[model samples]
Target chain A: MTQPTLGVWDVAAVSALLLINGALSVWLSLGIARQLLVAALRMVAQLAAVGALLTVLFGAASPIWTLAMASAMVLFAGYEVTARQTRRLAGGWGPGLGTATMALAAATVTLVALVGPLRPDPWHEARVAIPLFGMILGNAMTGVGLGLDTLTTAVVRDRAALDARIALGAPRFEALRPVIREAMRRGLIPVINAMAACGVVFLPGMMTGQILAGAPPGDAVLYQVLIMILIAGATGLGLLGAIVGGAWRLTDHRHRLRLDRLAPARPAS
Target chain B: MTNAEILTLRGLTSTALKDCNLTVAPGEIVVVQGPSGSGKSLLLRAIADLDPHQGAAWLGPLDRARMSGPAWRRMVRYVAAEPAWWADRVGDHMRHPKRAAELAVSLGLAADCLDWPVTRLSTGEKQRLGLARALEDHPPVLLLDEPTAALDDAATRAVEALLKRRRDDGVAMVLVTHSDAQAARLANRRLMIRDGCLRDAVS
Candidate 1:
């Protein structure tokens, strides 16, 4: 029964699919190509480095090092979101959104660790928990950036109403509640749609890969479903948390919105 | 003695308000007038501490730089020449619906305007909103920079009347305007700001 229906070459086939999709993305969007190329090259270098290290580390390294690496990944993800957005604005808003990234990654890791089957050694299973947590944070980071950009644009676009609020009796965040809510919804739509389309439009990469590696198809599908739910949950946390967490910065101590703090549009990139 | 001079600017220099020294007395309506770029509005901004100035500013007898930012701002409210906006609907700013209605009616604006988005409101209506904000907050002194420069005659009158009423209520007002008629309408004292200095009108 172990008649090797597919050789190691099958892994090559999967990687080829990743490249085709990446090339198609480049052809359709040059800007996306810039991001995708950086992401792809970085991913390969990191995964190869990790693979090389694992043979020795798993055999002898401390579990503490593995856990430390996970924490660092989450922190860096948060910082990445903050610096990327903050550099564009005048003040602390970028770091403020970084708080969203931290919350997102934490919630994902927490949910997986608490609800899923306990690994024989979670800290040691750097292979499983770290990758999964990272993927969730990465996706949620995209959603957050979209949501934050929308919120910033909406605030500026609606500046008159905002100024009037300070003129009136409304508090800063109180005045911006509606726009923030809308931006959160906008940022979340793509991720939610993906969740809904799962198993219908295409089998997700996690499930397909697991099945190819000799896991029962049903088992892989079950885990895939769980992961999808986790992703959606983490993204929701990121979108909602970011919208609320950052309201304080936008408003003055007297509860008035600070219009000058908004990031202006850059020369058309 | 002058209720501790709600706003005092010394050695104030700015593109908005050039080298100047002035005191805004408690409960007095003071209008600043000059041609554009003469720093009439800059005087108000310098007092409010919203713009950088070369000298010292005092709010209610406290050095502005010495006081905590929040404390200084609480004592002084700065209304820009172009009103700043951050909301979509006008009514949304009125956290209290009843006050919104009262303010809209008093400002010669329809109560339905509360429901209207800020985008739909004319420049004049928006200015009224800016003024309404300054008034609603009940700040001791109002630093207005050409608050009526962008308004129509009717809107202008409505705002002027409100300022007149506020002045009668003993609220100190710093009104920056090029229109002498506007200065005469509400200001008990019209100080001329020219060449980075404040002077009593020769007349």
Candidate 2:
């Protein structure tokens, strides 16, 4: 086996891909160059680390460790995504820390077993199952994080009018109806816009990767569509969690927005 | 609530307050006098429990600290010289009307001022709208901070006339004005804030 072709894995190739992504980073997220760089670095490290672990386990021909690693991947991705979104509303880190991990694990298991006909034994086919879950959950993490950020900022800015609604005999959640609607509007609009621009602007990463692996274009597109649907569903659920749960931070038990917490700005003198 | 919608402050010390004791009985007009930056407005806010101070302040039966922030403001109407403008329309005032059409009519404003956008309103119109908003609330304690500062002759006369009517109806008011003519025409209790202290007006 002629080293499986040096073209398949090369440092220069990877570096070139990173450089291109860095150059395009400005287009992806403006005014946040450092954040994009850090994200790219994280992506490289996380994928490479996982790739190495899987190779070692599979190379040793052990199925059990491979299955455990895949499970761990799903759990970790989900937990991190959920934690980032809900930490602010939970008021402290500990309450919503691992909830996302659980959500992701359940979604992954449900997708593999019930949603799709892909019934390969996870223990035997650890590579496919683990990486698939990683991509699925990773997309969800992004959507959820963005959704929560939008929701929090909107709530903070429009807090006065929002609280005014509450005082006018609107229920706490009812009072936040306008804000909640605006948050969801902002959260969903970006993803929908990107999806519209897909294919024409740039081949999605999943479809492109599939085509590079010599898969048929049509088949790759089909797979990408399925994955996209799953991601949207996951995103919707995650945003719902953020909107409903975050309502508590805006108001107390009596349906009054915490005004003492939002004291009017005082003069510096 | 209680008759004492405003918190009673005795010797309240803060950057916004001097050593002062203030009691605003229900249905009484108490106008505060001072030149610029003497903390007259701050004293009103302090009585409203909107200021941070060391002195004890009681609102009705509850301590100022204990009652919720929204509840406290609901009982006290504070019309700063420049009220916050969230929209461009005068009509949106009906969105949360504390009073009815009587005051709007009393101020010689057409009912359409209710529908008029804030952008279309003159400075005098906004001040009138602010006063109308305060009156709509019908709070037992009316805190006026330079209510006429932004007005021309006509708007000031209109506001003065409406305030007189409200006073006749026995709505308690705390008017903060630098104009002696304005105070002499409107105040039942005349107090001056000077160098962070409150005392009866010398005149």
Candidate 3:
């Protein structure tokens, strides 16, 4: 009982639903009709492009190609992390730190999962490795971005408090512990919520997709659990790396609160 | 390098402030008077090792270069004009609540003020508490930036009196202020800073 494959008209049927949204927007003078149209178009185009690329990647099934795809994803994720920040570190550290930490966390977790549990016939098999890497990278990216954003924003807002603590003889790490704890909590909250709400509040996207693809429910559940556990590990490690790196970048060996190292915040859009 | 000089700065230079050299003997208050944005705060921040600056500062015989920033700051504390409170209650911000409470009482703060939420503190009250917070550990050297800028006359007198008491206890201080009367009353030696330059004021 395999799920019917989606065709162009089947996709168009779904796409047509947007016309109703567009019509309502026009009727209400919401001014978002064009935006909605453009967003829908972009989503369709982007997803199609990714689907095509993944097909080609799977056919090739080469380790180098798989690595290249994963690296590209990691790079884009790093850029997204930086773009999400309101007040980023000065001197290109925003992206540099994010990319480095995300790559490290995602790559480490993905490699461990592949080698340890999944154990694909070829451990670096593109079909298995690329998707797994993408899922972990996506979740880890969000965590790292949130952690970095929280840390930088809090540090800027609480500069005086940090300075006072440092002046009061607190070490840099000791002074930043509270802020870092907040960052870690914020970074992990989404994943934690997903874990709590999985299967009950709503089936997670991966499990839903697997079920639709006709995988056995028990197998899908086990796989989803494994992926989620791996994601949590990756997110935790990535957030910790990004936050600690941010804290280190914000201060110096002399323990001065280097608020100057942070660029002046851009006005909220 | 005088043994009597508890706090000594030799050629301290920051981005805004240049080539500042001064010394404060134990039990002395060196009042720095300058117009706003004269880099007075920069000078104190540099001495506290809170900002990057070129110079050597010594706490008595100990060169600041040898000690970590926190270690140096422990002995030579910098109290900002508007000190920051990180916690909800004033007591949470103080390392030694009992000592801070004792100091707060002397500074005209209510005995129970430490238990009050930080939001309830007026500007003058925060200033006094900032002083009390800094004094809790009995740092040998204090770099005070406009410590009484927010106080009323009576409150100002109380803070000044407390500062004088700290000085009498051999706590050397470099105090930044705009008040000449306060300077005259408190400073054993007065200096003036203008456009990031420091020199002896012609009294």
Query: Across residues A1-269, which tens digit of lDDT does each residue of candidate 2 receive?
Result: 12233454585567776666667867776556677678877987987886788788756655577557756765565456445542244434222522453355336544653335556654356556555666655665566555655556566677655643443334567677776776666656645765787788878898988877778899999888766666666656666665565565556654555434322332222
Between candidates 1 and 3, name the one with more favorable lDDT. 3
Worst-scoring 10-residue span by lDDT in model 1 chain A: A82-91
Ranking by DockQ: 3, 1, 2
* Model 3 local distance difference test score: 0.90
**Regions more than 4 Å wrong, model 3:** A267-269, B1-5
Enumerate the candidates' DockQ scores in order. Answer: 0.20, 0.10, 0.84
lDDT by residue (tens digit), candidate 1, A39-112: 87798788878777666556555668666766676677766665555223455656556555555555555556
Interface RMSD for each of the candidates: 5.3, 5.8, 0.6
lDDT of 3 at B154: 90
For model 1, the superposed segments whose C-alpha errors exceed 4 Å read A1-61, A64-104, A107-117, A151-164, A167-172, A175-183, A200-202, A232-269, B1-22, B35-81, B84-89, B95-112, B115-117, B129-140, B192-203
- Per-model lDDT: 0.68, 0.64, 0.90
TM-scores of all models? 0.72, 0.64, 0.97
What is residue B22's positional error in candidate 1, in angstroms? 4.2
Q: C-alpha displacement of B192 in model 2, angstroms?
A: 4.5
Docking class of 1: incorrect
Error of 3 at B19 (Å): 0.5
